[model samples]
Target: MQDTYLHHNHQEKHLKSSELLTDIVIGMSDGLTVPFALAAGLSGAVSNTSLIVVAGIAEIAAGSIAMGLGGYLAGKTEQDHYNSELKIEYDEIETKTEVEKEEVRIFFREWGFSKELQDKAVEEICKDKDRWVEFMMKHELGLDKPDPKRASKSAFNIGLSYVMGGLIPLSPYFFVANSEDALKVSVGVTLICLFVFGYFKSKMTGVNPVIGGLKVMMIGAAAAAAAFAIAKVIDGK
Candidate 1:
């Protein structure tokens, strides 16, 4: 029993890490792609490396804010939804005691509990209204209570990841004097980073790392290429 409890704790920690990884992936994928594309586009249109660098910085700042706010709002929505459901569960347990008890019995029935054991479980569980409602929420509604701090944590993680990812592509622009030359270096660096990032991200989630890596690399390349093409056409006009 002690070993089982420890294993369950480990599983919970792993689940939280998985959630964090997902948020990082969300932020980093867009972070690498958008700034890289913007820089490529700007490099195509302008001869000034300074202008491209400045614009890339501005876009990263704005994009991080937008993405962080989106993550915060999503987390807040989940919390609110859980709270609303919890309240409803409590009310039902209070006002419809017999119906709630029957629901508990039905749950035990579905679990394949023996008739005598089901009666014993229901009798034991229903003695405490709080415990009864808690069980119903978990077993019936399939909702876990979300961490109250999840919204702020998600916002911080996503925003920080975006800043880190965005800096990679933009860093090359700072080093080179010419925008076109900087773009060439940035493309080489960013595509490699994208492949590596995607490979590990997929590997963590049990995907084929090679395929995922290539897919992500191609996507970054395509986005940059399209943006560069559009800017070149506009510049030619």
Candidate 2:
């Protein structure tokens, strides 16, 4: 019994960790791609590295704030939805007691409980209002109460990850003198980072790591290429 409880606890921790990883991937992927593409595009139009670095920094700042706010809103929505459902469940348990009891019995019955066993289980479950509401929330609605701190945590995590990822591609522009030369280095560095990021992301999510890596690398490269092409064409006019 103790072993089973410990195993369940471990699974919960793993799931929470995975959620955090997902936030990082979201922020990091966009952070790397956007700044890299912007730098590439500017390089095609302008010769100065300073301008590209300034633009890249500005984009990173704006992008991180937007992404963090988005994460926060999403987290808040999840919590709000859960709370709404929980309130409904509580109200139903009070106003439609027999109906709720029957629902609980049906669950036990489906679990292969004998008639007497089902009665016993249902009685045990519905004895306390709080426990009964919790049971209904978990078994019927399939919602675990979200952490109250999830919104703020997600915001911080995603914003920090974005800043970190954005800096990688922009770092070359800071050190290199020419925009074109800096872009070359940024391309090499950012694409490598994209592939490595995708590889680990896929591995965690149980996908093919090599293919995922290539896919992410290609996407970043294509975006940068397209942006550079557009800038060059416009500059020529």
Return the number of clashes found in candidate 2.
0
lDDT of 1 by residue, 157-221 (tens): 89888988999999998989999999999999999999999898877766799899999999999
Query: Candidate 2's residue-wise lDDT over 60-164, tens digit each?
Result: 999999999999999999999999999999999999999999999999999999999999999999899999999999999899989999999999899989999
Please estimate how well model 1 matches the true structure, expressed as its whole-model Cα lDDT: 0.91
| Candidate 2, run of 10 with poorest lDDT | 10-19
For every candidate, C-alpha RMSD to the true structure in Å? 3.8, 3.9
